[model samples]
Target: MSEDWTRLSAAIRTARKARGWTQHQLAEKAGIGFSTVQRLEGGAPFTRRPPSLDRIERALGWQLGSADAVLAGGDPEPTGSVDAAAPREAGDIGAPPAKRLPRRIEHELASGEVLDTEVLQLGNSRVRMIIVATFEPGDGDDQEAVAEDLEAWTRVQHQLRNMTPSEGNP
Candidate 1:
């Protein structure tokens, strides 16, 4: 079953344009890089990261699996909107639960740089963390440092998961 990249791209592009959004705007709303939106709109290829596609689907107000349906020569299904203030619970029929905002923290370093972190709990025992570093003006190349810092945290998390009770660490 080959996927129709052209069909998917056209659907996404048409939806985005109908919303009067630029590629950059869609990328920001989808929490992805701008080039990703370009690639998708250009029918370059499907993303290796499946979560990126999921994010794009949600950002475009499409129901889950709408992208796959589109690639399979079907139209995207629009998601029914749920009020953020509406009282809802898990397993509710019809509409999904309202989205929750992420917890954010910001710290200013002595060098006048700022680090912002957002923590979102997807479900029980599953959390996603995003870190953004804002260097002072004229500091053009600190993203690698931020990525290294995030990698270090990932390593620490794995190490902690591997610890046993006999190690005398909780």
Candidate 2:
């Protein structure tokens, strides 16, 4: 086993005991079998199949590197920032911060122009002309408000029969 396993398992046992829970309790909490905890504490090979790391973490109120993983040599963290590992600064140990790079955002807007289109539907011998209604924004407002309105005004075209409607009658 890796040297880290012994250290990690000891850490697990320490954390569990600090909470005043028994091996069975820790097993139940970590979602692993009772023997798993016992083996880990005794530095023996794990007797139970591995459980979900997420569940185990939740049970221990910790973020992985637990007893079973240590005993079974199941957890092997890479030599860099582990994904979702809590971040740290210089002179700070372990993973780094969770701050992500700023995302590029773009705002697009369409003017108050009613768009019309023609569509042909197959299987029913139906031809359709579609009209989409829109409204231009008032002057003197920030582009954001107009952009919001434009976003809200993008409606689907109505399905219409061939040719424009004249007077009444279907």
Which one is best on lDDT?
A: 1
| Steric overlap count per candidate | 0, 3
Off by over 4 Å in 2: 1-3, 45-49, 52-54, 65-170
Tens-place lDDT digits, model 2, residues 5-69: 45556766776677677776666554456676676666443343344333334455654344445
On TM-score, the candidate that comes out on top is: 1
Q: After superposition, how far is residue 76 of candidate 1 from its true place, in Å?
A: 0.6
lDDT by candidate, in order shown: 0.63, 0.47
Model 1 RMSD vs true structure: 17.9
Expressed as tens digits, the lDDT of each residue in 38-120 for candidate 1 is 98888866644244666677778888678889888899988864122322233332232225222122223444465443344
How good is model 1 by TM-score?
0.49
TM per prediction: 0.49, 0.33
- For model 1, the superposed segments whose C-alpha errors exceed 4 Å read 47-49, 82-170
